[model samples]
Target: MAKKEVLRLENVSFSYAGKKEKAVDGTSLVFREGEFAGIIGAVGSGKSTLLYCCNGLVPKEIRGKFAGTVRLFGKDVAKIGFPEISREASMVFQDPNDQIFNLTVEEEVAFGLLNRGMAREEALAAARKAVARVGLSEKLHDDPSELSAGQKQKVAIACALAADSKIILLDEPVSSLDWRSSQEVYAILSGLAHEGKTVIATEQDTCLLSRHATRIIVIDGGKVVKDGGVEVLSSSLIEKLGLRPPGPMSCGARK
Candidate 1:
């Protein structure tokens, strides 16, 4: 059977207010369910804007000039609206502090559920399961600000899972973490993908992207230059694009 497409961007382009250049220029891509996709690109390459467009944050909330079509689950995102799209797709920003504002970890995860009309007891129960998925069951009552950066990111993921989101979009999830911490977070995300969640994330670490991502997408100047499996990381195209080699290749592993 053919894979089901979860998100589709057809000839999509976006320009921010007062900006002459389009942040996302004629980008077209399709994301399938059960795939862990990594979007990699240089600074200002429009990877972030593309991610926002996946969940209707662009044009709808960000106030940009958007063209072309962005469809999530066969429904036009522009027509369905943010609240409807948000129920199926959740975005985690680079900074966990921005998302985790509640006093406790449980509160942090359950807040979304409560807002969506879930009962308090039921929301807490669901939050417990989500926290356990991220291996944070013991820290359920801990202050989010006191947790390490990586731990905080995990909490953000737990919030997404708690909300029963099918598609999770993350922007530069490990941009500020140490190597060990970054791996820990990716492992959790990988686990989520294994459990049938569509994990789409942007990352600068080619090594992690090569080893963790099931599909790698190289976006440059708001266009998808390459879309393939992990083997793409082993290709010479990395140098042509001015990207560092995959960690294994840099460490003398065979191409």
Candidate 2:
């Protein structure tokens, strides 16, 4: 079966407030459904800025001069507000602590649904199911404030799921997690991709991405450098690109 188009960017560029250089240079690309696209690049390469553009953060709340078009679900992001775009393209930031705030895991996951006017009991039930999907069902009543870094990240993902987000955008999701935790988070993302959601993430861990992401996109100097399958993570190219070699190309890479 052919995948459907989910996002398209046309000659997009953005310069942050007071910044001389464009954070996101003229870049264009298309993303399709059921794809776990892993974005990699050197520091300050505009990986995060590109994600912001997809969800209408750039030139919106961030207040920057943006050029070109970023379309989500065939709608111009610049033409809509965050609340409208966010429902389809939910963003998960680098720091889980920055995103989580509810007392219990259940409440944290249910926050978005409740905000959208879902009934309290129904929202909680949805939250429970979302939490279970992330393998954190046992911690439903536990305090998100005290959970491990990895667990907190899972709860954040659950919040996206409960909100029924179709495109999950993650920024350095596992930068603070250990090896095992990073693997677990990528595994969950792989599963989500398999279930037909578009999962895009900025990651420093190429090994984890090599094992899970269906597509690999490398960015540098605010533009896409290389974009392809696991083969793009080859040791030679990885070295040339200043990215950590992900060792052997794991056979587990999603199709």
Candidate 3:
């Protein structure tokens, strides 16, 4: 029997406002529950655009013309209410600072839960749980402005988890972090996947993808050129697809 798909994109295409060509063109893919999927591409390859469509942020926040279908958890994203979508899919952007608006760490984590109609006490408890899960329990009362970039990203992840979302769309989650922090974030993301959440991340670091992702989808010029398990994509093909090969350690010490 085939595995159940948590996300499905069927012949989807998107064009931003004032743009002549589509940012994402005729893309079709499936992301199953408990899968860790990575998207690798060169700059301007429409990786982010594809993620936006998955989380229903494309036609909602972006001024764009969308054609075709995107379904999340068996419901059409285009037809799902924004609030409902928020409950099912949460997104963390490339920049943690862009997503951190609340003054305190706790506030940031609780924002989504509150918006979802969770009572104050329940929301606070959930926030605490999420913070603890991300190893940010000690920073709950800290000012969001005072934390390091990586800590801020952890808070952002905590906030996403507070919503109890089934699908997470992370855009370049580790691009801005230091090596140690990047590993920390990867560990957290790995744990989420282990808990049966679908994780889809767009990354420039193919090494990290190879190390942590169950599958990698290579995109170029707004289309998917390759999609397969890490071992199935050759180093040469990764380079030809405009993606770098995994680091030596990631590739079993091979360069």
- Estimated TM-score for each candidate: 0.94, 0.94, 0.95
lDDT of 2 at 197: 96
Q: How far is candidate 2 from the true structure (C-alpha RMSD, Å)?
A: 1.9
lDDT of 2 by residue, 59-109 (tens): 788888899999999999989877778789888999999989899999999
Residue 173, candidate 2: Cα error in Å is 0.7
Off by over 4 Å in 1: 249-255
User: How many angstroms is residue 224 displaced in model 1 relative to the true structure, after the best TM-score fit?
Assistant: 0.7
Candidate 1 residue-wise lDDT, 1-255, digit = tens: 867889999999999988888989999998988899999888898989999999988988898789999888899998996667878998889999887789999999998888888899999999999999888999999999899998899898888889888899999999878888888888888887888889999887888877778999988888888999988777887777778877654433322
Q: Candidate 3 — which residues are off by over 4 angstroms?
A: 250-255
Relative to the true structure, how large is the alpha-carbon lDDT of every model?
A: 0.87, 0.88, 0.86
Name the better of 1 and 2 by lDDT: 2
lDDT score of residue 127 within candidate 3: 96
Residue 80 in candidate 2 has what lDDT? 86
lDDT of 3 by residue, 94-126 (tens): 988888888889988999888878899999999
Candidate with best TM-score: 3
> Candidate 3 has which clashing residue pairs, if any?
none
